[model samples]
Target: MESVAVVATDRAERYGKQLVGHMSRKISGEWTGQSGYLDFNGRGRVELSAGADALKLELTSDDSETERLEEIVGVHLARFGSKDGMSVAWNRKSSEAGTVQGPYSEEDMKAFAEARKARQKA
Candidate 1:
């Protein structure tokens, strides 16, 4: 029960593929399935499955880290054509509670923060 995070400036499809490839190469586990969404403006949710675990990655306009993950998911769909950038979060699951955790790389957080600030200024 661990997690990995990645930051990319590409669309969800491209980003998802990159994530999947990286995880497949780096982690020794069986992949299950991926379920998520992409929008007209190339922002969306990118969730993937590995064995009995689930990884949820989201991109949306809400800037609050305290916001609910589900709300962020909705916002991604609601603000499809908007110019605002998105916030992303990833969580993993295992047999034990709190087994999976994230906020992995500082650079990823910084990139997201910078993008959010730039979007706000625009």
Candidate 2:
């Protein structure tokens, strides 16, 4: 799978869950684990499996499609989690394109914190 596709898929899953949570509050209900696939075509399509009102989220990017997907994920998180539930997870995958790094690590976090404190003291 392409790195772009993989990232888009992961984002779609998270956005779907966030959408569910956001809608659930309106109906006073909870989301039960749903599955879906995201396709980066003209825009993008997040097709969810049966359950939770069977929603399909459509996001389009006229110029920067990848960036659009990222923005959609942000919006979903803001609407549902409101900062509390927002999080990022990294995964390793080897595809025809190449190996892709997902996100930062604990060591990276520690280093970042140390650097921030040092800068603050200076």
Query: Which prediction has the highest lDDT against the true structure?
Result: 2
Model 1's C-alpha root-mean-square deviation from the true structure amounts to 14.1
Model 1 C-alpha lDDT per residue in residues 77-118, reported as the tens digit of each score: 223312324333333332322212222355555665798999
**Most accurate candidate by TM-score:** 2
TM-score of 2: 0.31
What local lDDT score does residue 14 receive in model 1, on the 0 to 100 scale? 40
Global Cα lDDT for candidate 2? 0.41
Off by over 4 Å in 1: 1-10, 28-87, 90-122
TM-score of each: 0.25, 0.31
After superposition of all CA atoms, the RMSD between model 2 and the true structure is 10.6
lDDT of 2 by residue, 68-120 (tens): 45444434433343323333221213332222222444565567579879999
Residue pairs with backbone overlap in model 1: 60-86
lDDT of every model, 2 decimals: 0.36, 0.41
